[model samples]
Target: MVTKKAPSAQTAVDVALAELVEGERRWAAIPLSGRRALLDQVRALTGRHAQRWVDAAAGIKGLAPSSPLIGEEWLSGPYVFAAGLGALSATLEVLERGESPLDKARFGRAGDRVTVDVLPTSPFDMLLLNGFSAEVWLRRGVSPAAAKANAGLAQREPSRTNGVGAVLGAGNITSIAPLDVLYELIAHNRVVALKLNPITDPLLPVLADILAPLVEVGAVRLLTGGAEVGGYLVEHNSVDHVHMTGSARTHDAIVWGTGATAAERKLAGTPKLTKPVTSELGGVSPTIVLPGQWSAADIAFQAEHVATQRLHNGGYNCVAAQAVIVAADWAQKDEFLAALRAALAQAPARHAYYPGSDDRVAQAAEAYPRAERLGPTGERLLITGITPSPAEPLLAEESFAPVLGVVELPGTGAEFTAAAATTANEAFAGTLGVNIIAAPATITELGSAFDELVENLRYGTVAINAWTGVGYLTPTAAWGAYPGHTIADVQSGIGVVHNAWLIDRVERTVVRGPFRPAPRALLHGEFALSPKPPWFVGNKTAANTGRLLAGFGADPGWLRLPAIFASALRG
Candidate 1:
């Protein structure tokens, strides 16, 4: 019997890059219709393998098949990915008809910036996500005509060719890698060589099957290995551009080589890697709870929302809420904190699956020794009475774990909003995303000042009455750090992805949802039918709802609506 050695990581990377380089021009020159067809194939394959994908992810995260937490895998994996592909497919359809996707989109002005309504693009979006709204705010000086002309610039001249690009897949979220691949293929017009993070190696088989259509066409090549493979692909001669969804530490090491010379290279503005790079590096995201005359129900609901923001995916998310800002003088502050503690305590226990999560949590504990340990296994940590100062460790670092911190500020209305905004801007380590939770009456009271504050907030996505994860999942909304970081300082990285409409010069994506769910919203005089979002960690019917939603997303049809609604209403 002859024994064959496994192909080495370097050799595998070489083969993948070679394939992508060969297909680079072909992929870029393919017509929009052909691209859309490929997406259809991917969506179909994803639907077929959806269950296996979620199962594998759940197993990795220590979630049993029967665990409601399995719903997280389903929603973050096949469901959101299918939705993203569907969104991209729709954009390609419009492009094929010789029209910009934004031609019929609603446009408005936020301050001096032009804003295009991205959500509610279809009747289904309006019906299913009734009160949720999102807008892509263009950079200042971008006229409406300019925004229209810039949308889907790559697709307009379908035969134009860009070179091969490298995508460094994120490990935490199953959908992130696939969505990044889609973005590179459709929005950037690049054939991709994707290197899976070692931590997500278990997903190799599932992703290969889901992205089989692209792999077959040579438009994409998915490889798996450690940092050696990633370094090889990014530095390869054939790769023209690079995109990554990871940490600032990783981004810095990639751009400026590590060790003794790293600081020197940074200060001298000399990156070891010369290729143009884009990244979605997360920072210490904040949840600003604006003071409102919140009722008992309001406090409880919003507390759960805050908990969901911090505990989703076991808080391994780049945009997870780390610092929660609330008015110290607000009468309901103590009540809200008590409710949040209860929510955290009641949350299902989850293993710390991510590498270094235990160390990170330990570091937080060291920084705040008095931090409360919540969760069934005491896996969740909460540090309260955080002063709004840059010296605070939570304010300076991104704790990508089930750790939450509360920062207290003085004043109310615009006064509190301004202070909270200032702390969020100056203290947070990154600019990836932020969340603002405000009651309807409070927003109405603040009015134009509120709008101005939102406009001025320097983050990639500003989520109102919703977690920043909502913006991340919304394909139309641009996802990245606030524009203006360089490779040296690389805060939250740079550039945007998952922008289905392909709008150029994006400043930020502002997403807003109802302050409360249905029945409660009605009681608060807000007209929205949305129930507890399936992504909520405490959502009891999430497993069923997420499954139905995944099917609908993959193969959208009117027939699927009732089942989804039935499951969601119970949650």
Candidate 2:
């Protein structure tokens, strides 16, 4: 008997790409029903391994299984992924019936651009995410009729041919990789070669189990390694297209070869990677605070909201609130800052898990030495009085850590909003997302002007009284940067993902939520039943609520609603 040697990493890459080439040939020919069945199988597998998946992620992130922070893993990991599967399954069902998913979609006008209501898509959405709503704004000149016809074009066409696509996963977010795979397969009708980030190597086993449905069929191939393997897959001749969820640095490195010559390549409008590329990149996301007559309760609640926006996942999110813009003359500026500081201090301290997070936090501290270090361990940083200048490090860079910067502008009401929007558009490093926090009275007073303000701000997602992460989690809503980005200057990278409805000509997603929770919302005349969201850092019952939500997402049914509501109410 002779000893056998396993194939090397390079050989594995070659084999995976070769297999995906064949898978892509058959993927387009598979009817809608067959694809739907594959999705259903994956959803079931996700439910079966949901707990193990959450546990593994928690362990990697320094969260004990019993720790409340473990909720972050459950929600961001399996819950959102499961929800995406459910959304895609529903879309497939509609397509199989030879009907448009947008047939019943409500359309409205936003500054001459047509907007389609995407959230609260079903009665279940209403009950689950009660006060939350999202709208997909179409590109200029895209009529509602055109949007309806263009929705799910790949699925509608019978002669569509597909090819192999590569997904370079994000290290920070667990669901980004799988969700990107889902979008590539369903939305683009392509087979995928998913390369997990090195930091997420621990998840390889669980993902292999959960994604076995597609892996077994060769429609998807999961690989593990670092940049060398990733570069190999990206440069593979057989891979037709590539999509990535990471930083612009990584995107640029792949598109234009890194080194001193990379700049010259970018300037010359030439890319080393000839294949079409789509990416979701991070940026300095802003949370614009409009001057308004706010009560103390309003100040406290919104402060926590802002803190959660910045500190969720220990501030590793691409949409994390990097800067909070406020009016310098606002009377309650001090009060709001104090409240926000308290909120930051109250959140439990966790390890800086992501690679280079310590250096990033230290860089923010070094730049702004006077920045306040809050929280138990003093790792949470809050820098104040930052000027909106290109020279400002925080303004020009994505911190990707537990760091928040405050910039105060001189104005009131619409004037402040317009200035802040302009600064956010010009000063921020990327156009991934921005948030606006305005009181109800202020919005009512501004009316159409407020809509105009939101319309003019150039971000993939403009969230009002909500974190842009809500838009990312809403599978029906498109997620990416503002359009018109060329291959040379990929700000937040090009193209959109997680758009289950597959509506094209998308400009951005607008997500709005209640400013207050439950009883307080009722007092504010906002008819919303949701309690503190599970993603909140201080939600006591977050672990329980997130677990229940995961179960609900895995297999949605009326029977699961009560338990979910019960856990959420306590949170």
Candidate 3:
């Protein structure tokens, strides 16, 4: 057996700091046009090596090398990176013409705040990502005019640049680490030295290939490391800022300390690393199933929608629906549950890929001994209860495994929606993601009432008839918690990422999709959906669908739609 150890963080920092400072200087000095050119190169490289990138990520995660399910690695991986490149390039292009990227985007008024429509920006995206649209609700008092001036702070205020940032890559997602680094480069004008997660560090070399153009220009550096390397990088004087995608526990230890006295220090507002820190931490996300006149087909579509949201990535997702809230008095509660159970029961066995996932699964199983084992291999589990108190493990903690707990509450229409919103806000520990599943008729009946319902939810990203992960992938949607969390109680951690539009201080992003794309995209498996969704693991055509989607996103055209639909039809 052989072993590889990360270099001493101190030594790594010593070697890189001088060069990083110079890189940061050069990064800032580069004009908007130059930045656009840099991103153009990144986009080309990402598309050029898309398959190889997906292959490397899928292999590491133990997915079948050619399995359509590996489409997760493709869409969430290279597709996201390539999409970010295009979006960031457009943002810089706006700046080159002395315009605010925020102003360049379309906006509308949502209550007191201004909402910028972030996605489906062109006829191309509309033709491609049909049935999906996203908008970022700016923080209150941020008028559309103010939004333009406040956007792209780094370019507007050059003095605010933090020279070099250390991005601690997350093991779970292939694209997150690279995309996080790109934000520091594009938004803050900071050169980055990214320390890849030990769990997925091997993918670093492959990512390096996609990001070679940026690395060549000294915009990014890739490093391999474990806790020691991460600790060193965060504490090193040379590293001016840090960001992460992990647990609040990790963020605390880094921002506070590791000793027995860590908790007291955290309470006292004492110090550890003084450098500015930002993170995308995990949370116990919830989905509220609003009562509707759902037909049998609609019930089944939503069942898979809820189950697939949970089971995606083998349930090791921050946005995974760990908690489900349903109206107890609804006529179709049992029907929905039966459909959901049927979907979960048919789950294909997946490797509990993340470290410590088995223990977490066992813990959830122990907490709810009555929980059903959904898969033959026992990789998936379901915990059912009638609104367990907020203190229950199912509600308080992130399962981070294939365990979903359902809690039922009383109500029908407005009453049900209100109670569901309250439950998701107070009962769930995270403010990361939430889904509101309701029919268009129900919404139309609610009319003006629906807007308030959307406003009431505190989660960072709210999705209607879709997964909050939609907001995560949309380059315009700010991905993080619903604002106003300090380092002390950092629920879903702090800050936002994947916001390539260069807007700032986002409150939340709203993404809405048809319950089913066209008639039976999720029901009879027929759809008008373009760039067919990759989240459906059972779709036999998922791999081809993913490849076609990646192609369409990179180069949207009328010529490509026929082929994309052909592949989508095969599923």
Candidate 4:
């Protein structure tokens, strides 16, 4: 038997804190242009070292080098960092200029000044859905009063006395933790130190090199170790702010403590100490298939949608759709399931992490013993029959595998909408990305209710007719939901990431995709050869998209026709 050793608590904390201090000083001193240049360099470095990074990441995660998923990660992961750079640059421009135009059509003239519209992108069919929007007050001359008002709206300043940031990287996804670090440093303008989970230790050297510019400039740093290190870092006196992307149980333990400490804290109605820790704990995100919207083709399209969300990264994602909330009266439920099963049957199984994954799946199987199983080595794609209790562990708890739970509610239009809203609001984990698939008719019929649901959903990202995970990679979409009570009440983390354009954000983001066919579908394993793609696998895709968008910018109608056609045809 092979034995694993945990790092000493003191050693881990020391290393993490040292990095944090360095990152803080560096971020505070660096000029915006220098920061931008470093980001650009990192983007170039990512492309140059793409294969090496992928290999290192795959080796550590125990993934096959040739796996399509690995290819996706290699291409889409780094682009998120590049997108972050772009967003940071835009933010800086807005900061320096006092106002930057985002969308022209949404702008209306208020006397001489322009009123910019920050309406989030809404699905074409579901215009009634409440979308998040932020208003940017702009004028030719800088108004001190307006600036003061805008400054007051800022969440927290970088100079706050209690400034501290800790990042806990995900064990399965190599890019997540580092991205979180980037958000804290650039988005929130905070000092940050990242603690690497043991499973992803091999990539630490690569991450160190990739982030060396930030380190050399003192904007970021990385630390490696296990539970002791994590515990010490979270509990350290100097660490005031923290963020983690991992299990909800882990977040609970850190905030509430565990064992004797937890019991004491509970009895006393107080935690060990109050630190503002934020976490992107896992969620059992749901996809609501509204009736009347899906055809055989639509069902097939969405089957790939659900399958891609679950099968991506072997279903280790926090925002991966774990449950499909369908209307009981929907005629195409069985048809959609058939296509979903077929798609899942073809997906490769991932390496089961930690020892209990198999056990967890087995436990889930007992509730719906007939559920189909898929990969991880003859892994079955388990689907539970329609049940009365949608709040069962299979639906509520994070399965962390290819297993999906199905729940049917009796209703067609508004009734169906109400049930989905209730379920998503009450039964889901703290953080979620709720996906609602509605036909044009269904959307029209329940437009008001859908809007209400979108606003009421506790999730961070509520996607319409698309998988919610895409929000993570979209440069315009903010990653975090909203601020929670405290470190203890952190439901889906405190901040956002992957928004390279760094605009003023609302509470949640709503991503609109076509109900029938999207321009690029990375979920169906189709992006392998397509020019347009949505794979969150690597950061290269962002650069490609940026370049393509920039080219399109150069020529709106004529020169970019090929690129536009390629994007649509590729889908």
lDDT of 3 by residue, 237-346 (tens): 77878999988788888888888688788778876777788889879888888787888878887888888889888887888999789888989999999999888888
TM-score for all predictions? 0.98, 0.98, 0.95, 0.80
User: What digit string (tens of lDDT, one per residue) describes model 4 on residues 42-77?
Assistant: 655655555566677667656675554554455345
Candidates 2 and 4 compared by TM-score, better number = 2
Please identify which of the two predictions, 1 or 4, would achieve the higher lDDT against the true structure.
1
lDDT of 2 by residue, 1-571 (tens): 9989989888999999889887776776778888888899999999999998987788778886777888888889898999999888888888889888898899998888999999999899999999999999999999988998888857776338578889999988799999999988888878899999998989999999999989877789999888999999999998999999888888899999999798888888778898999999988999999888989998988999999999899899999999999999999999999999999999878889998998888888888999999998888899998999877999897889999999999988778878988899998889999999988888998887798789889999999988899998898999999998877878887999988898988999999999888978998899988888989998888998889888888999999999999988988
Q: Write the per-residue lDDT of candidate 1 for residues 1-571, one digit (tens) a residue.
A: 9999989988988888888877876776677888899999999999999998998898788887888888888888998899889888898899889888889989999989999999888888987898999999999999989988879967777677678889999989989988998888888788888888887888899999999989988899988888877888899888899999999999989999898798889888889999999999999999999998988888998999999999999999999999899999998899999999999999888888999898888899898999999988777899998877778888887889999999998898888988888989988889989999999999999998798779778999999998888888788889999999989888898899989888999999999999999978987699999999989999998998889888988999999999999988998
Look at candidate 3 and tell me the lDDT of residue 198: 89
RMSD, candidate 4, Å:
7.3
Better of 1 and 3 by TM-score: 1
Listing every candidate in turn, what is its Cα RMSD in Å to the true structure after a full C-alpha superposition? 1.1, 1.2, 2.9, 7.3
The 10-residue segment with the lowest total lDDT in model 2: 153-162
Give the range of the ten consecutive residues with the poorest summed lDDT in model 1. 153-162
Where model 3 places Cα greater than 4 Å from the true spot, the runs are: 1-9, 157-160, 386-388, 520-532, 555-557
Which pairs clash inside model 3?
A: none
